[model samples]
Target: MPEFNEKAMHQFNQGLIKEFRENGGKAVSGPFVNAPLLLLTTTGAKSGKPFTTPLVYTKDGDRIVIIASKGGFPTNPAWFHNLKAHPTTTIELGKEKFQAKATITKDPERQRLFDAQAKVMPTFNDYQKATTRQIPVIVLERI
Candidate 1:
């Protein structure tokens, strides 16, 4: 695998964020085009700063679910840690934005949600197989 470049990733994320906002939370082009996505804004765990990340999401009832796959990397994503420290967050879906509370799911529910998303995205299955740590499944409920 190629080495991870934090700066490059940040730049890419900045562009995606701009596109998502300008297009009403839709990615009209780029790798995430047409992919179900949402903007998750979480308070930084250590920085005490607000950080926004564009993530692919799935829905369960009235809640939104996101996986911290990090492309099956060894460690969880930073946003995951941020949510753990501060569960209250902001979610931008489609053309709407709202406050939400993040809940990390466990066991059967986690498995169920992960499987459901993998069926829709397929790549999640591969992401799971790539690492030993069980990926975290989080539910964001409107607040």
Candidate 2:
């Protein structure tokens, strides 16, 4: 199979964002909605501006986790940086919306959690091979 096209992938992300906004962020189901996931917005750490990104996530105890795989890109995603600068963020699940604090998990702990999640969605392993950067998973705890 051909490698995923970055340009095309970005276009798709843009489209997903547009559709998500117009529809109040009700994720288009199928396998993605199998586990409870939601859209989240993180304020740009450096710019101090907000950005919304739809994410596939799952709950780990009381925390909601989102992976910054960026389809396995070499660099960390912008949202990761935003959360790093400011741990506070917002999330929308189904018709409910609320705020949360982001906690960027590091080694050992991160690896264990990532592995657990990858079991639920194996594509995550493929995502790692597609990029040079180690994907960072952010755990959002309701505040």
Candidate 3:
């Protein structure tokens, strides 16, 4: 894995976000190709400004699930906190965009969903083992 630097990751994510938007939510190249991804726009907790994050997601019935793994960093991602403060947000999946409400999943269900996602993207398992803190799993229910 590459070195984990916040600044570098931010720049990289900016590039991915741009590509995702320009390509109708599809990542034309890079590791994200053939991978499930969505643009989640949230209200910043402190800044109160709108922030958008590119995330890999899985669908469960009518809900979309995202993990706050932060690539197994010690702390949760800012987007996670943002959504916690303002549960209502917007999600862009493929060519479709819609509003949704975010909720943190509880235990049992959280673990189950995490395992299901790990099965699809094995790197998630490695991410879990990389950090001491238990990553959070968030569900986005369309409004």
Provide the global lDDT of candidate 2 against the true structure.
Answer: 0.79
CA RMSD for every model?
Answer: 0.9, 3.0, 1.4
lDDT of 3 by residue, 6-110 (tens): 888889889999999899999989999989999999999999999888999988888899999999878899999999899999999998999999999999999
Please give the CA lDDT of all the candidate structures: 0.94, 0.79, 0.92
> Best by lDDT, which number?
1
TM-score of 2: 0.81
* lDDT of model 2 at position 11: 74
What TM-score, over all chains together, does every model reach?
A: 0.96, 0.81, 0.95
Model 1: which ten-residue window has the lowest total lDDT? 1-10
Model 1: runs farther than 4 Å from truth? Answer: none
lDDT of 3 at 83: 90
Error of 1 at 58 (Å): 0.6
Lowest summed lDDT window (length 10), candidate 3? 1-10
Local accuracy of candidate 1 as per-residue lDDT tens digits, 1-143: 46667688789889999999999889998999999989999999999899999999999999899999988888899999999999999999989999999999999999999999999999999989988999999999999
| lDDT of model 1, residue 90 | 94
Ranking by lDDT: 1, 3, 2
